[model samples]
Target: MSIQVGDTLPDVEIRVVSNGIEEGRTGPLFAGRKVVLFAVPGAFTPTCSNRHLPGYVQHLAQFQARGVEVMCLAVNDAYVMQAWAASQNVPPELLMLADGNGNFTKAMGLELDGNAYGMGLRARRFALYAENGVVKALQVEAPGEFRVSTAEAILEALA
Candidate 1:
């Protein structure tokens, strides 16, 4: 089933990079904290690079001030995610997570069919507000739309 509000995030392993590449479980990462996790179809795509990710990056402080940890999740590999982070000059406070094999994306039932685009398996654009591992609010954008998943929308939902 698709994850929804009031559901505990699946305890699936997702990859992240700090001093070096590391793996973290979704449950532990979302535990005991308020988190805003947003996913893009892929890194470096026009909408993702120009808007989705940047929206969160630009308003990062606002999210932090409200005591929320902001994260960007994508189906790309750690190397691609790391390069995108560096190219965008993403702040240390914001985390970029890679669901290398689409394990987490598939687990959440948010995988997009990218076969037509030659991208293979990818994540559908979405965002969620989770507190202590339970989802409080969730937004899944319609294809080719950028409304509900933006930082502004998520912030408003939090309010």
Candidate 2:
């Protein structure tokens, strides 16, 4: 089942780049804070790179205006995620995390198989509004869909 609204987010390990060095961070970054967590299937994928990510990039100011901290999570490594963020010009304020090995994605129950495309476990496209480490709004897609989970949708929910 998907992580529903009001579910307490699981504690998962994250890789963080500090001064060009990669280190693992545990516990939850969203603890005691409001966050907009988004998951995508893969990095550099069509819809993901094009519409999904850009929507967040474009409306980041609006999200922040409402006191929301937006974060993007993927089942990719820290290196790839950092590169993708740079390539897409995502702002520094937004948290783009790498959930490598699917530990966090699996914990959120949003894991998907992209073996046909040579990609293993990945996260489905979705978005959640979390406050103080607990979910307040949830939007898991309908498998091949990507409408409501966009940043604009999350912004609407936040508003």
Candidate 3:
């Protein structure tokens, strides 16, 4: 089943580009903190680069002002994530996570099959809010749609 409100985030290894691709678990990242994690189907894709990620980048301070750490996750590797971040001019505080191998995506039951697109396994476009390791809200988009998972939408939901 897909993760829902009140579910504790699954423990899984994720990679982040810190001093050259440091690895860590999902547990401590959400433990004792409020987090807004949004995933894209792929990095550098048209919609993701133009709308999804840039929305978060534009409104990052609003989320931070609400005491939430914003994260952008994709199934790509840390190197790609780092390059994307640099290309987008992402702020240092906004984390870029690499869910390589789709472990975390599968654990959350949010994996998207993109074999037809020649993309292989990828993450569905979605966003979630969590506090102290427990999910509070989740917004998943319909296939080929981008509605409820936007930064503005998530902030409005939090409000």
* Predicted model with the maximum lDDT: 3
- TM-scores, each model vs. reference: 0.97, 0.92, 0.97
* Of 2 and 3, the candidate ranking higher by lDDT: 3
Q: Give the count of colliding residue pairs in each prediction.
A: 0, 0, 0
- Candidate 2 per-residue lDDT, tens place, 31-148, comes to 7787888889988889999999889999988888888888888888888888888889987887788888888888888889889878889998899988888889888888889888
The CA lDDT of each predicted structure is: 0.91, 0.83, 0.94
Cα displacement (Å) at residue 91, model 3? 0.6
Q: After superposition, how far is residue 96 of candidate 3 from its true place, in Å?
A: 0.6
Q: For residues 37-155, could you state the per-residue lDDT of candidate 3 as single tens digits?
A: 99999999999999999999999999999999999999999999999998998988889989989999999999999999999999999999999989999999999999999999999
RMSD of each: 1.0, 1.8, 0.9
lDDT of 1 by residue, 1-58 (tens): 6888888888899888544567888888888999999999999999999999999999
TM-score for predicted model 1 compared with the true structure: 0.97
| Candidate 3 residue spans exceeding 4 A from truth | 18-20
TM-score of 2: 0.92
**Quick one: ranking by TM-score, best first?**
3, 1, 2
- When 1 and 3 are scored with TM-score, the better candidate is 3
